[model samples]
Target: MNSITHYLHNELPRINAFLEAQTARLDPVVRPAAEHVLGAGGKRLRPLLALVAARALGCTADPYPMACSLELLHSATLLHDDILDAAVMRRGRAATHVEFGRTGTILAGDVLLALANRLVADYDIPRLNAVLSEAILRTVTGEVMEIANVRNTAMSEERYYEIITGKTAYLFQGACECGAILAGCGAATERAAHDYGLNLGIAFQLVDDALDYVSPSEITGKPSGGDLREGKMTLPLILYLRTLPPDARQKLETRIAQDDLDAEAARAIADRVAASGCAEATRDAARGYATLAAQALEAFPASPERDLMADMLDLVLSRNK
Candidate 1:
């Protein structure tokens, strides 16, 4: 295996352990449900980013608590998001709400969110908790925006970016910022970390949106054309719109605005978006952000940790699932 993959293998188990161990202090009733979501498989991307950020900045203190906070925050979002989206599967398993019931899953997610904040609070760095809290607030706001804009015909590219930056990028930005803060890095370096994470997070979401149109169910652990059926206008569909003639664009917009689109109709439109090369266009946009993310790392001097973090950009851009 390549170095990045090898490194990921080395770190994944350690972070997974940290994620599980954090739940031990929770009330027993909520503990099992919390553990269930935590145990459900994931790449643990947010936590790993924090750990790597701390290492890159030459941190001496243990970073696991801070690192794990990102995962807890992210997991909590997943639990709540699955419910909001009415999703049936996550990480190739039944969604937490499906197995645990919606109320239990929601409570479990809320507990985990609190636990995440508590972990940061224990650090005694008021800024760390502030950073995490802002991320949570922004993330939730993004979700609300996304929900509000469903089937919205006038959704502009600028507006989409605004929503996604909150929906995905802020948490990523917060993760790196917390990592840098924990390392006691200078303000300039901390800014660099923030830029890198913000751009990378945008790229990550763009790719996910692109994949929604093309990836098979097994690959994404979700239904094909799920976004289209749900009336969510993603980057691929948005880009595809710009290429159509006036009448066709109007028709497509009307279709997107439909209160209910069946599977066949959703699949058909998704296929057209894929075949028109808009998915690739979305990926190309992702590459631009990925490049920016790489440049952000240049603010720091060379080190194995820095190089590993840079490699993560390539990994994010290359994700097909």
Candidate 2:
């Protein structure tokens, strides 16, 4: 396994233990649903970021609770998002809503959110609760905004950035900030870590959008053209639409506006977007964000932890490429 995967494998058991111990005290009905969602596999990127950021701040304290809190918050968001998007699959299996039913999934997600805040409240770290609370609110708002923009062909680049920053980057920023807070780091260090995670998160999402256009269904664990099928306006399609001649743009828009998207037509549009260099443009933007993320770490003293964080930024781009 790669470094991140290896870290997760080693640390997640401890985090899971912590979660189990805490949730054991909760109401019986809520426990099973929370456990089910928690046990559902994920990349655990937010939690890993929390742990790494703590380490980067020169702390040796166990980051298990903090990491677990981050993971809980992330998982809650995923549950809610899958329900809102009507996403059928998650981690190559039925989504939480698909398997548990919509109301059950919503309840599960709410439980996770409450559990995450409860975990945060247990931490003795000053201001951590306020930061995490704000982050969660922002993330929810971002999701709502994105959902509102869905299928709106007139979505602009600026609006897309706003949605992505809120939906993804804020949680990452909160993870790093919480890490630094727990580690008793100074404000400057906390801000640096926040910037690092924020930029990395943006880059990660950009690459994810790119992957939707290019990666095989098996590798991506979703059908190819999933974004197009859902009529979600992503970076590549947005850029591609701008580059097209007037008539060509009209035809593409008409196809996209259809309720039942034709797979062949979607594939053809993806091919045209690829041929038009929009994917490359989107990639360039991702690289720029990766560079910014690396630059955010310059304040920290040179160490393996710092290097790993920088490597993670590169990994974000490399994964989708």
Candidate 3:
């Protein structure tokens, strides 16, 4: 594995240990489902970020509890998200809701969320609870907004930004902020880390949306056109729809709303979006956010940890999976 991957691998074990320790105390009925979903390996990006941010701020103590807390919160959100999206697959396996049934998955998610709160309860850090509580609320609001706009056929770019920022970026911001809080960093440094994560999260989601249109099934671990089938509005489609002739746009809208798009139609739409420069535009926008993320690290002292954080921003920009 590369350096970042190696670092993540080392850190994740500690995070997982804490998670297991916490989950072990949960009700027996829900514990199995929670473990099943948690054991399904993920990138563990949020927890990793917590560790990275803490290290960048010169923290040398164990970050495991904070990391575990962030992961549990993230896992909880994913469980709920899978149900909301009716997502059938997660991490190359059946989604928790599909595997355990919706009610079971919901309870498991709730259990994980409660575990996260328990992990943070003893932290004794200023603003920690306030930040976490707000992050949770914002994440739910973002999901609700996205659901409300699904299949609307007229969702605006502004609305899309609002949804993604709230749903995805807030948690990332919280993770980084939690790291800074644990490190006892100054408010400015804490805010900078939060900004870095927020921008990185937005960029990450944009790349995910782009890949949903272009990546193969094996690479994405999900079927191509799944987003289209769900009537979800993404950046590429929204930008392309704006540039199409009125009649073509209308037809495309009807097809998308009805989820009637075939592979050929999906490809045609992707090609048109690429040809119209919207894909490039979307990529440029992601790059801009990545740039901001990198800039957010300027206040930190020069160190390997800081450089790795910057490199992570680049990785986010270029990642295909």
Candidate 4:
């Protein structure tokens, strides 16, 4: 089994080139903002997922164009998310909103989304178009629900899963499903690919939430405790609250409810959650999902690509950013 790093090194360049060329076509005013984010380095995981799934299903032709569409879609979502989160940083640089103003940045994001639709439509595949559309709707619905439930300290673990699945997992599911569709895989194989992506995405989000509490801003490319500062109850904070005594839990909840949880308070809570071992527990939960993601890969026959898919669990579980 080749490591994801290996596949990434071999596969990401084509996706990157495709993204660069496509982004270059934006309106003159929109081009710079779009380029800024497109040029900013990311793991390119979604596109890589698409490429890997296609290869695992025995496709020989280049999948870069199709895979890059997923990257564009993911980038569009991030642009909107930064505005909603009031995020100042992304990919270790100022967020698009910070650089281009909210309106311009939002317009740039819309352009990327429109390009994604255009690219997908270029294939003239109805199933592919339908999958991407459903995924976009799910992502928007998840974001809206997340905002509506801000500071919901009593939000259940089940409900939290629903939010993350819609926002994060569904796109991953779409990426893998897209790969399968592109490769002309059988129905069962496509379902397996989707299952793999869904579980991997859930684990990825859990780890990301844990990273928000424990990783330095330099490492994560965003401030630690941003979720807490924004009043979003992620898995670590949720698990930590469960272990708290009544008085402590109430105090913590009150602090999170503030419109502005200052840096000092946010750092303190982040530290407390880290110290309470909830961070570790959150990682453990992620590991469980990673296992499920790996299990879903068992339906595929043995091959380097399938092995790479199986190995993705380790990559997702251990990633720092």
For lDDT, candidate 1 versus 4, the one ahead is 1
Candidate 2 wrong stretches, greater than 4 Å: 1-6, 19-28
- Where does candidate 1 stray beyond 4 Å? none
Clashes of each: 0, 0, 0, 0
Please, what are the lDDT tens digits per residue for candidate 2 over residues 61-144? Answer: 777777788888888898888887788877676787777788877887888888888777776665989889888988999989
lDDT of 2 at 226: 78
- The TM-score obtained by model 2 is 0.92
All candidates: CA RMSD (Å): 1.3, 2.1, 1.9, 1.3
Which 10-residue span in candidate 3 carries the lowest summed lDDT?
266-275
Candidate 2 vs candidate 4: which has greater lDDT? 4
How well is each residue in 69-142 modelled by candidate 1, as lDDT tens digits? 99999999999999999988888888999988999999999999988888888889988988889999999999
Model 2, residue 34: C-alpha shift (Å): 3.3
Q: Model 2 scores what on Cα lDDT?
A: 0.81
Candidate that scores best on lDDT: 1
lDDT-best of 3 and 4: 4
> How well does candidate 1 score on lDDT at residue 120?
88
lDDT for model 4, please: 0.87
Better of 2 and 4 by TM-score: 4
How does candidate 4 fare on TM-score? 0.97
